[model samples]
Structure formats: structure tokens, C-alpha cells
Target: MDQPTRQRRGLLIVLSSPSGAGKSTIARMLLESDKDVTMSVSATTRPKRPGEVDDLDYHFVDDAGFDAMIDEGDFVEWAPVFGYRYGTPKAPVKDALREGRDILFDIDWQGTQQLEAAMGEDLVSIFILPPSMNELEHRLRSRGTDSDEVIADRMSRAASEISHWPEYEYVLVNRDMDQCVAQVRAIVAAERLKRTRRIGLVTFVRDLIGPAH
Candidate 1:
């Protein structure tokens, strides 16, 4: 087989950080490098920017559609942010898990909490932080995309977000982008080796013990 053929144990891998903290970048790099893993496409009421495609960057929806999905209990996790609502749809992620593929989530801490509540042990959560406040501010300012007002708002929120670091299973300080990617990759690799996540290994191990010996 080209890849692991046994049934894929579904995993809900979450990477949460405040805006400009590089969670999205790390998530994308992980998806690009791992064949068995994929990004969870989120449903959103936020308007798509130029060159964004449906079911790629997001499953763009209107407020009514989003409400309908919520009413139907179709979201694993969802939240409103900056005047728009975004959510992870339940069905596709469930299907992906059944296929032995892992799903990656780049969302906020609140969404992480909801996902953990919905899926429990299947979720692997990581919290990423900037090396320092100065570095964080530098990253936010370097973009030159946010206005002074928006940047201040993001910084204010970052403080509260960082306060929740202890809530995650892992904490990664993204001082160097490459190092941060490596750290996240290591976390995924370690999680995949977890005994509970590899139930199939039990049978294989028992076989090695032999029937009569």
C-alpha cells in the first residue's frame, strides 16, 4: 500500500494562537508535508477575500445558512469573531476521520474548547506563543496590513489568549518560524505514536508473543 492501509483513527489536532501568532502558517505547512493529514475546512459568514475558493480557505456562507447549520448541530465547533461567525463542519471531518486521515484545526481558544468538548480524547491541542511581547508586536506591525486601531485590538486580545496557554496539552514558542514548524511536526509525530491512537498495534504485538510460547 502507498500509505498506512489500516483504518485511520480520527484525530482532532488543534493549533490555537492569537492573530499573527503563526498557527495558520504552521497548520498549512503541516498539511502540505503530511499525506495522511488534511486541514479542516471551516464554514464562515465572513466574506472571502480575493482568490479564495469555497471549500478551500473556507465554506463561505450567509448568516442564514450559518444559522441553519448551527440549528442542525452540524458544527463540531463554531464561534463569532470580529463581526463574523466561523465554524468547523462536523460531517466532512467525521468522514475524514473514518478514512484514517487526521484533521488539523487552526482556530481560537474558544473553538478549541468547543472541539474538545465535542470530541474529547480524540483531540490533540497545541498552543503557540510569540517569544515575547515585543516580538509579537513586531510581527503584527511588520504586516502593515492592520491599522493602528486594529493592531491595538489584536494585541489586547493576545494577552487574554496567552493566559489560556495552560489549557493546551502542548505549548510552543514561535521565536523562529522554522523551529516552530519542527516543534509542531514533532508534536504530531508523537501523538500519532500514542498507544490509544494505535489500537491496531495490539493485535500485531500479540501475534509476536505467539499462541503456545
Candidate 2:
């Protein structure tokens, strides 16, 4: 008979980049193509934007609700961004890792630090960089989603975010979208094969070698 499939622990994959550096695009492509991974929906105290579905986009909650969750120690990591609070609920992340299902996080450096402190070896972080600062500014303008003032603010924030690139396990220069996505996928594939993640590897290898006789 064929042997049962070996179980493995999941990864907490973090993708962080400066605004308009293509991490969001890469993340969407990955989620569409990768079946073993899923996005981690965060709980936020901010109001949902138009067409944003609750629990799908974000679990919107009031300040009081967020405070309650904090008091109960329900979050694995939480942070404040733009005067709003966002947190990764502890229960779902814990469950996913135990089930050998990966979770993706699209957050900034501060949030990544919190997760790294909480998850250590279970986390694999990637920082995406723009080819050039000029090119980064160009992409922000091309999006047409923000005013010049807002774009300038984002550019300043981008510099700060890029300074933290050394914190990640992998760094990719996103000169080409398709190539970057491919490289990130390769990272995921390799990380999944890590000995620590493969919880059943020892037994599987033992079975292959046959009982010590």
C-alpha cells in the first residue's frame, strides 16, 4: 500500500514593499494561482470602503470592539496605521499553521516586526523593492489614485519602508512584475520543503529505511 501523506506545518509568508512597488499585484497573482496558501484577513477599526466586503476585505469593528479583543488577548499581532488599528486574530492563524495551510500577510515593516517577534521560525518574509526611486515615484503617479500631496507623502513613507529591507529573509527588486511573482513563488516552494516545516519527515525517512533489524 502507498504510504499516507506526510503532514507539515504551514508558513507565515509576509510580502512587504513600498507603496506602488508591485507587492499588491504580486500577492493577487500568487493567491489566484496558489491553492495551498490563503490571505490572512485582518480585523480593523477603520470603516469599510465602497464595495469592500466585511470578513472578506477586513473584519471592521468599532474602537470599543477592538479594545475588547485586545483585552482578551485575541490577536497574535496588532498595530496602529493611519490612526486606525489592525490586528491578526490569533485563533485563525494558529489553526491554519496547525493544519499545514499557509497564510499571506500584506503589511508594512512595523506589522512585519510584530509578526516576526510572535512567530520567529514559522515566518518567511520578503521585501520587494522598486528598480529606482524615480521609477517608484512614477508608478505612484501613474496609478492616479492619489493627489500630488498624497503621492509625495507616500514617497517619503516608501523611503522609510525600504530602509527595513534587511529585516526580511528574501529581497526582490521588482523591475518586472511577472519575474518577481515567479521568484516569490519559488521562495514559497523552497520554504515549504524546510525540514522543520515537514513535521512528518523523520517518520517518513524511518519508514523508507525499514525497521532497524
TM-score, one value per model: 0.93, 0.95
Q: Taking the tens digit of each residue's C-alpha lDDT, what string does model 1 give over 1-213?
A: 313324347788999998888898888888888877888899999999999998888999999999999999999999988899999999987787666679989889889989989888889999999888888888899999999999999999999999999989999999888899898889888887777877576566667677665
Q: Each candidate's root-mean-square deviation in Å?
A: 2.2, 1.5
Can you write out model 2's per-residue Cα lDDT over 1-213, one digit (the tens) per residue? 223335789999999999999998999999999999999999999989999999999999999999999999999888888689999999999999999999999888888998999898899999999999999999999998899999999898888889999999999999999999999999999998887888887777778778792
Candidate 1's displacement at residue 94, Å, is 1.4
CA lDDT, every prediction? 0.87, 0.92
Candidate 1 weakest ten by summed lDDT: 1-10
Provide the lDDT at 41 for model 2. Answer: 97
Candidate 2 residue pairs in backbone clash: none
lDDT of 2 at 210: 83
Highest-lDDT candidate? 2
